[model samples]
Target: MATWAQFAAAEPELAVYGRELLREEQGYAFLATVSPGGAPRVHPVVPFVADGTLLVSIAVNSPKTRDLRAEPRYMLHATVGDNDTEFAVRGCAREIFDDTGTKWLRAHRELNVIDIPLETVLFALEIDRVDAAIWDDGPPHRQTWRAPNG
Candidate 1:
């Protein structure tokens, strides 16, 4: 998998749209992680993409957090609304636990959520592939972006 900066550098325009889809207000997306038994477990999540990183903050004590720590491979899919625009990424996730991560988590007031019982932790998904299906007049336009081996 490649870093978000690497993917953005390779495909700026697509990255812009993809990032918006992931960060849009009330946006819907699904995060797929490997279960202990090697099965796929999908969960609804909110994605935040900024400063060349795509991250998702989940409950600190959640099973998903442990799942990602054990196995980083993941698939993230954006919900295609009535517009029929689709976005997805495949990558490996890594937890961000330093002060830098803490600051970011604090800056985003949305993550300061009170209803959640457990604290939240952020995980960055270094993107490997990006796919989009944008609606047009006729057939939907499709595009895929891949990072160059560096």
Candidate 2:
């Protein structure tokens, strides 16, 4: 798995486009996690890149948090645009309990103009692979990038 910075360094163009798609809808992205019952659960999450990592803050008591704790593997997909542009990353989430987590919560609260409770937790989405496509006429332009150790 790789940090966002590493991915950007490895695939500059695709990384920029993917970042745009991820932040297009107010940093909205769909995060897919594995439920304890082995079913897939999707949640709308706000993702932000901080300290070279792609991070998302979750409420400590949220089912999403529970799922990540039990099963770190996850997929995060950018919200598709009107033109059907798509971007997604598959990876494992690593829980953060350091100052980075605190900084993320504070920044997130400020950005959204709301209060984020202290019980919130942050997770870094370590990328295994990235996939994207852009559709215009005929077949869509597609690209994929995998981490060196992924």
Candidate 3:
């Protein structure tokens, strides 16, 4: 798996577009995890980058949190407007507890009215693969990247 910075370094343009799609003004993404029944459970999320790490926080006892702890595999889809442009990331989200993680979590709590940033569980989604499609007058352009070991 690769870190966000590494992905950017490998695919500068694709990474830039991915970041733009993820951090839009209405910043949102859909996090897909496996439910206890082995089905996909997707929920909207506010995903952010910290020191090249992709971190997302959820309510401590939320089903998604439990799902992640139990099975880290996930597919995170960035919100694309009417263009039908597809941008997505697939990876294993591992629980994190480091200074970088804490700093972001704290800042998040200070910036938002919600308590989840301060009290929720956080995980870093290491990039296993990235996919994007771009449209420019003609047929859409597709791009993809896989971690060196992924």
Candidate 4:
């Protein structure tokens, strides 16, 4: 298996953006998780940052949610700057659906108050490694991490 650091090293534009936006800011992340049958499911997730934890909500019936529930592995990607930079991470997913989970679920009333189950679990990945790959710039840049040292 490729180490998370090695994986990130292959893509630098992603690393640069991750280093920049991951600090006390709010942004969205795209999640990819494997289904029980080995197929991949991708979903756009609105994330919350608190104490360095990136929390994402998933409904029980959603494909991505089912994927994470069956397999606790995931990959996340985010980009900025007219697509000049890309940030990605690979790690394990954890579920949170208790008291605190309710608070997070209710944080956005406009979106979370829908008839869909509000008690959906929270899937969080602690960014095991980050990578960046820059295009349309001078030269491609890169960096790897054993864990998110940000």
lDDT of each: 0.80, 0.89, 0.86, 0.62
Q: Specify the highest-lDDT model's number.
A: 2
The list of candidate 2 runs beyond 4 A from truth reads 24-27, 113-115
lDDT of 2 by residue, 38-144 (tens): 99999988788877799888988999999999999999999996588999999999999888688877877777644567788899999999999999899999989
Ranking by TM-score: 2, 3, 1, 4
**Model 4 agreement with the true structure over 107-146: per-residue lDDT tens digits:** 6444442343575667666566656666665775665555
Tens digits of per-residue lDDT, candidate 3, 25-131, equal: 64579999999889999999888887788889988889999999889999999888457787899999989877777788887667655455477778999999998
- Candidates ranked, most accurate by lDDT first: 2, 3, 1, 4
Winner by lDDT between candidate 2 and candidate 1:
2
Candidate 3 lDDT: 0.86
Off by over 4 Å in 1: 24-26, 110-118
lDDT tens digits, residue span 12-99, model 1: 8988787777764536689999988999999888777656778888897777887899999889998775588888999889899888
Relative to the true structure, candidate 3 reaches a TM of 0.91
TM-score for each candidate, following the candidate numbering: 0.87, 0.93, 0.91, 0.68
- TM-score comparison, 2 vs 3, better candidate: 2
